[model samples]
Each structure stands twice: as structure tokens, then as C-alpha cells.
Target chain A: MPNKNLVGIFDSDEKMLHAAQKAKDLGLSASDAYTPFPIHGIDEILELKPSILPKVCFFGGATGLLTAFTLQYWVHAVYWPMNIGGKSFTAYPAMVPICFELTVLFAGVSTFFAFLFLRGMHPFKTSPFWGLQTENNKFALVFDLESESKAEKVSSLLNQEGALEIREIIE
Target chain B: MTTATASSEILRPPLVEGGKTYGQITDDICAPMEKRPPLGWFVAFTVAGLALLWGVIMVTDLIWTGVGTWGLNKTVSWGFAITDFVFWVGIGHAGTLISAILLLFRQKWRTAINRSAEAMTIFAVMCAGLNPLLHMGRIWRGLYWLFPYYPNTMGPLFVNFRSPLLWDVFAVSTYLTISLLFWYMGLLPDLATAAAHAKGAIRRFIFRTLSLGWSGSARTWRNHEKASLLLAGLATPLVLSVHTVVSMDFACAIVPGWHSTIFPPFFVAGAIFSGFAMVLTLLTLSREFLGFKDYITLKHIDAMAKVTLLTSMIVSMAYLTETLIGWYSANTFERFYFINAATGPYRYCYWTQMLCNVVAPQFFWFKKFRRSPVVAFIISIFINIGMWLERFNIIVIGLHRDFLTSSWTMYHPTYVDWGLLIGLFGLFFTCFLLFSRSLPMIAMSEIKHVLSSEKHGEKQHA
Candidate 1:
């Protein structure tokens, strides 16, 4: 869609934070900002929406509880039921542990998978702009390059915003 | 230094040394894996690997020759193998508590130790998972029947839905899954960092896939923190429930020593105690060898010692209460179970348990002893030994002298049992060694996220 992507790198979090604000104000069409650690309030600065992972956890947990109950009911009450130790045929008291466990199992694992699905984690993949410093010490903000004129404008604006480096990201 | 300290900067020890930057923290924590691993890594890995090999051979032989290789008999049917099962599972508890419970409590000191501790929980549970299977007599179907949906071929009846043993299957598997999810969810950001630092394309690719293309975007962080907190909430109850179910395995039975209302809390405390000891043992050695003293500071060790001290006291009270309740209940069988445990053939186990679990941790009350990592390490090893004996006393001692005098038998572990126990250590250490070298063993982003707060604490301490 563009000639080449432009990436602005910043060494300090403060500079990166302010630079994102500046780039947004300057209307540079920024999409991604990568940092070593999470910067507080940066999501608001990046104009991204809030995540929906909590809903995933909630539904997953409910499903888990129902699954546990259903599995126990199928085994104990409906299919091939038998008496043991003179106890009741359906063991509600005994099912609580499995119920709790499955609730946790379903909620934790499903939420993690949902997270990966949302985040684009899959086998045999590489991060788009993975460099030695990017995920460790440096922060990067990537923008699309529209044209040679726009690329020059992006570069000068990044420089003015106190970016450490501006590079043309071919991939 | 004293002049700076005089100006209202009271000298409270900081959990993280205050001067570290985000980059320095990353480089320092990842250094063991990034650089050529030190000589200590080789020594530990080689030794642990050989030991793990021994364990694997022993387990294979066990499966091939049948469970008869163990010293278990009808009188003490669930001997060392079940004990080892409970032992390893108990040892797995501290990691989740530190990562989930302590995180929920907002203890920042957890950052330095949570990664390795959670790794310990996973590996310890893996070892624990093996014991029940090995204990199952049928070689071809070792505990496969225990699976609720394993397809009962010959029977009109399903597997026992009411059995505590069945509950164990759900509990342990759930514990493992949640621990893994929590651990992996925590690792995503750090894995991205490792991938970025990785030299070869293969290393980069592997870590990148594992990291799920994490770019540490603020939105991603928001999701990650939310997901992690929710998982922590889910895991907190689990850390309590898993062990409670494990305790129910013994308590649900009618045996004199095994049946008690207090068993759940007792086992939970003991599990945390043993788990923390194992964490301390591993982290002490890791910090010394990996040059992480600055990150895994004396404060971290001291805080762990305090936990060790608190749990040990609770455990000792549990021991006393078991005997006290037995005495007050005026039940002869229950009273004799306690008496026999303390004064019978296994008095050695009882005394050593009292010494190591109850007495040894008392040393932590001294600030000097708790602050010294070497001392903490030694005390932790003693706690490990004591906790294993605690399991032995509970499982074997009670089972050996059950109700009928005619059925009484002293259970001694065969060479296979001992080999398997020692071999699991190798298995655990080897996994840890590989982990320490292969992954970012510390939560770099989480630590850096708190750097400002740590700095504020340092300013107060200066």
C-alpha cells in the first residue's frame, strides 16, 4: 500500500510517550508503538480501544462450571450409575472439587488462547520489526510511508519530536 | 553515604537495587542465557541430566517389570509412590502463591522470584504427575483408567465419580493447566524481549512464536495485565483448592491418622512451606551462580524467609493440633495413631519431622540468619527433608499400622523407590537448568514496570 514503512525509535520512555502524542497531533497515520515495558496511559495516547479479554474469561468460567456439572451428572446419574459405600447415587458434595477445578481450567486456558488469537500469535511467525534493541531497551513507533514527499515529512517530524532514529522499514 | 542517609531517607532495604534502568535490568536478567553459560551451569546441568536419566530408566523398568519393583504391599498399599505424589504436589504450591496470591496482594518483591518459582511449580507438578502413574500396577494402562472419559471397554459401569482419587485427577490436571497458563501468560512480553535479543534466526523464530508477536504495545499491556490479573484471581482459589483435594484423598478415608477436619489447612500450609523451601533452594543456587544478587536481592531472600517462618509455625501448630485433637477426642485408635507416630517404629521420622519442620525454621526469627542466603538455603534444604518425612509419616506410618494388629507391617522403600525419589530431583534440576539457560528466567518487563516505584523506595532508603 505504501513505498516503505517509516519507523521512529526512541531511547527513553518519556520521549517516546511525548513523541507518540506529537505524531498523533501531526496526523502521521501511526499504527504501532513498541516498547520494552508497558508505559502507563500510553494506550489512551495511542488511541486504541480497551481489550475484551475479561468477557472471554467470564464466559469461559461459566462454561467450565456447566461442563463439570454435566460430566458428573452424565457419569453418576444417567449413564451406568451404581451405588458405592452406601452413599447416594448422585454425588453433589464430591463434585465440588472437580467443579472448581474445571472452572479454573476452562477460564484460564480459554482466556489465554483467546488472547493469543486476538494478538496474532501462531506457529512459524516472526514479529514485524523485531530488532535487538526494540523489545529490550528501545521503543519504536511505525507509520506507513505514503510517498517520497510524505516520507520526508514523517522523517522531519520524527526528528523534531526527538526520536533517536528514523529508519525505512522495508518489510 | 551517611550524609545522604541523614536527610530523611530512612535506611529501609529496597527489594530491587534502585540504580537499575530498563536496559540494564533486561541485559542483567537475560545475561545468563545470552552470554555463554558459566561453568556452574554446565556442572549443574550435567549432574541433573545424569540424575534425570537414572530416574527415567527407573520409571521405565518400573513400568516394564510392573509396580512390584516398589516396596508396596496390601498392608501399606500406597507407600512411597503415593507419598512421593503428595510430596511433589505439595512442593508445587508455593509458585502459584507467589505469582498469583502475592501479586493480588500487591507484593512487588514477587517480581524477582516469581518466574523461577512458577517454573518450579510446573516441573514439580510434572514429577508429581508421574508418581501416581508409576504407582498404578497395570503397565499398559498406568492410570489410564483413572481418566473419566478413557472409554471403559468391558464395563457397563463408569469410573468412580465419587472417589477422592478421581477428584485428584481433575484437581491436579487443572492445577497444572492453570499454572502453565499463568506462567506462559506472564512470559509473553519477556519472550518477545528474548526473541529480539536472540542471535540466530531459529532462536528468534521460536521465541517469537512463543511470544505471540508481542510488541509491548500499551493496548497489549492493558490486555495482558487484565488477563494476568483475572488468571491470578482464578489461580488464587486453585492454589488453595488443589491441595485441599489432595488432603481429602487422605482425610476421606477412615484411617485414624488420615481422617481429620484439620487436614485441609494443615496440608495447605505444609505445601506452601515445602514449595517455598524448594523455591528458596533453587533461587539461592541460581542467584549465586547466575550473578543475579542485585536483582534477587537480600530483601527477596529475607521476605521468603519470613514466609518460610510463618508457614513453618502454622505447620508446627498443625502437628500439635492433630495430636491435641486426637487426645481431646478420647478416641483410642486416633490417640494410638498419634502415639505410634511419635513413639513407635518410626519415631525417627517423627522426631526429625519435629526438628526440621518445627524447630529448624525458628532460626528465621533472627534477622541475621534470615538475611544470609547461604543460611536460608541450608534451612530450606532442611525444610525439604523434613517435609518429605512429614509425608512419609502421614502416608506410610499410618497405613503400616492401620486398625488390625494382624495386618501391621513396616514398609521399607526398595532401591527403585529411593532411586526414583533421587532421580526426580535430577529431573527437576535438569528442567530448571535448561530453563535458566533457554528463557528469560526473570520477568524483565514486570520488573521494569515497577522501576519507578522501586526508585521511590530507594529514595526513602537512601
Candidate 2:
């Protein structure tokens, strides 16, 4: 917990957006923010890339399709064929509904896990500032404390940009 | 910028009333959970609990005594059990439509009601799951057979690939899994907020664990939004496919009333129709009792009424088409079956359905009924009753009189059948009550997005 990071709190997202932009404009590196809800421009303000979740979901759905079809066919047609209702063993039309369901099922499950894994999140731990209500009415900007010189300048910049509260956090 | 835009703006208020802050929204939604239940809540909970207990007893009786406890006979093998299953499944549809479909459509008002509706969908599906489980007299063995495990070890004779019933098993289980994940993903951030705000250590710890250490970081939020959007995209087709498969269980059958090409679309429309009605019914009571008027708003109620009206019309048209096709096809059994649905033993049910579902929702077309929660709530109840009878008439009426006149017989539900059917309401309400207390009843994050514009505008003006 000895590593310190500078944090500034704001009441509204607009102020956070302004402070982040001003800090970035000033050539100060401010990379992290916490908000009660997503501010539309915060991701771009911090210059984060678009998430890769959709592509992951697409692959998940493809895998699901392959798995669903193969299982249905293998069980019904290849393993032990049956002649019920005088229909063919594969019964591909009847299998279509389950296949469609599985495709969705796989995509949803994979995307959820991808979301958690990529975010470096797990249920067993909490954020360093979990007690500060960043996910409620207020917003917080978390910046690196690379050095005392860099940290103090960012702290003063946050104050100048009307940060409601500024605190130093040991991480 | 334009006069038309200005006029429309004047005609409607902003989506959320009171200009509620994120803090205020949390307070409004979460305060009830911390306090003792109101007198009405106590009474409602007690009654629902009793009904649930009664249902449990009846289901136990059904299990111990066998499936014969109800009233399934030689011809009418699927009775109230399947009818109730379909009805409950249909009641779950509006949740997805509001959460997934409306999310895709960018309907912001959905934020106010989607949480409760989705929870309702899960609960309804739970209640729906019961009948099929109980319908299998040997559930211990039957469920074992329904699920796949080491399929190569099990013979093909064990399961039929062509059966619609088999398809239903896959469709419903998948629907439930996706739905639970979707609901939980939306809940994570809110739970984190609740954990941060919570007083007790244990409560905070519990909420924190459930929240999965959500810090609402910009990067995390960006990924969260993408994942949610993708899930919504996946769920939209799934919601439709689940009911379509459910309909195929009947349509794929060779029975006169059951085998119709039109069943898929008709059932989908009907499922959504009944689902919206249930959503309205629960929301009307919850919004009033929970004091979410500013959040839920009159516009949400009115817009929901419009959906109900539209879906009801589609359902009515489907009903008419079925009847018309029966008479037009010159199929004696189909014609007689449709006719007997109106004139035979279950004619009361058929007429009641016509009154409640088709005729009752017509009032929503008028602006006054659409605006009044009392009137709307009452009508929603009627639509619910009507929808149940509609399923009843479809299932029971169709089976009561099979093709051969000599074999035809009237199927009446015993007291046990009535008990279990009525009791499902208890289970649904109980789950909802527990949900209302334990979680943010509205999608707080989404609603905050709607407030962001106003907050930003006011900031600039300052």
C-alpha cells in the first residue's frame, strides 16, 4: 500500500471531462477515471481503444454452432441411429432450433468471461477506493504518481480545474 | 431548431422527472430495502407466501401420488400443466422486449422498468420450469434423460432428435442461462455502488463480492457497454427463437387445432402481449408502492399501454385467422374443433378470453385509459386473465375433442390442478418481492446516462 496515486473528485461528469481534457492538454498524463456511470467522452478523453468484446462474441457464436451441430449429429446419426416417426436420424430441421439457441448461449457466456478477464476484475477483490462512492453521485480521476515533481503539478492542476476534493491514495 | 421539434418538446416532458441526481436516484430506489415493509406489502407478501405454500403442498401431492392427482386422461394427456407452462413462458416475453429489444432501439425510458421486468421474466420462467418438471412423473429419471452428459455413453434410443419437446429443452435452458447472465451483468455496477454506500460490513462485503470489484473505470465501462450491446444483439434473436420453439411443440403435432403453420408468429405475438400485460400489472403496483413516479413517469406507462394495444390487436388477428382458416379449409375435424371451442364445454373460457384479451385492451387505444395507472392496472389484470384463458382454450379445448366422436370426452381440472395453477402467482410475486428489496429496482446506470445530457446542459448555462 506504499505506492501513492493522486486522485481528484468532481460532482458532475462534465467537470471530470473538463479536468481530464485540461490535464491532457497541459501534457500531464492522467489515464484513469471513475464515474457513477459512463461519461460518453471519457474513454476517448483517456485515449483508450475500442473494446475487442464484439469480435470475441462472434468467435464464441461460431464455436457454439460447430459444437451444437456436431453433438446433435454425432448422437443421433453416427452413434446409435433410431427410426422414430419414420424420419431420418439426423433430423436436421428439428436440430436447427437447438443449434440457434446454443449459438447465442455460447456467445453470451464467452463475452461475459472476456469482459471480466480483460478488465482484470474478479469478485474476490475490490477497488482501492471502494469506500469513496465513485460509482454513486461523484466522479474521480486516478492519476499515476510517477514522481513527487510530476504528482504535485497534477495535484495543483486538478485544484485549478476546480476539483471538489483531492486525496493521495496508497496502492 | 424546427417548429415541429419545439412543439413535440412542449408536448412531452423530459424522460425522468424532478431532475434527480445520481445520489437522489439511488436514495429513491434503495431506501425501501432498508426500511420495514408497508402494511400493504406485509399483507401482499403474506398472501403470496401462503399461495406459494399451498402450491408447494399440491406439487408435493402431485409428486407422491403421481401425475394422476390432477386430471390428465387418455386423450388429453397435456392439460393445465402445459397450458400454465406456456402462459408463464409468455408472461416472461415483455422483460426481454423491454431490456434487449428496447436497448437496441435506444429507448431510454426502458431504464426505469427493465430491471423489474427482466427479474419477472426469470421468475416466470422458473414457474414455467416447474410444470414440465412435474409433468414428468419420474422427474428423477426424466430430467436425467432430458439433459446430455457423456452422450456417446447414452444410446440414440434414449432421446429423439426430431422431437420438438427435445428442442424445447435446449431452447428454454439456453434462454434461462443467457437471461441470468444478462441480468447479472447489468447488476454488477449498481451492486458496487450499493456496497460503497452500505452501512454494515457483512452487507457491504456481500454486495462487493456480487459486484465483482466494479470500480466503474472508464476502460471497464467501455468494455461493459460493448459486452452489453453484444449480449442484447444475441438475446434479441434468442427471445424470439425460444417462443417460436415453444410454439413448434404444438404446431409440429398432428392434432387438428395444434397443427397450424400460423402458430409460430401467433404464439410470439401472444407471448409478447401477455408479457407486457404482466409487466404493466407489476409495475403499476410497484411504482406506486415504491414511490418511483418521478423515475417511471406517465410517459412510460402510456408507451407500455400502446405496446399492449398493438400486441393485443396482433393476437386478435391471429385468433381470427385461426378460426377463419379452420372453417375455410373444409377440414371437418378442424372446423368442429374450432367451433366446439366456442360452443362446446369450454365456450365460457373462449368467450372470456375474447372479452379480456381482445376487447379489454381496446380501451388502451383511448388516451385516458392509457394515462390512468388504475384503469391500466385493472385492464392489465383482465388481459392477464384473458391470456390464461386463451392458452387454456387453445390447449384444453383442442385436446377435449379429438377426431373420433366416440373417443371424444370433456377434460375438467381437479382441485389439485386449480391449486398448482393459482399458486404459481405466489412464487412469481414472492421472488419479485425479494428482488425489490435486495437490488436496485431500476437500471441506475442507464438512467444516469439519460440524466447526463440535462446535467451537461445546465452546467454550460451556469
List where candidate 2 sits over 4 angstroms from the true fold. A1-3, B1-11, B151-156, B457-462
Question: Measured by TM-score, how close is model 2 to the native structure?
Answer: 0.96
Q: How does residue A76 of candidate 1 score in lDDT?
A: 86
Model 1: residue A1 alpha-carbon error in angstroms: 3.6
Interface RMSD of 1: 2.5
Best-performing candidate as measured by TM-score: 2
TM-scores for all candidates: the values are 0.93, 0.96
Best by DockQ: 2
Candidate 1 DockQ vs. native: 0.57
Task: Give the Å error, residue B109, model 1.
Answer: 1.2
**Candidate 2: what lDDT?**
0.87
Task: In candidate 2, list every pair of residues with a backbone clash.
Answer: none
lDDT of 2 by residue, B274-332 (tens): 99999999999988998889988878999999999999999999988999999999999
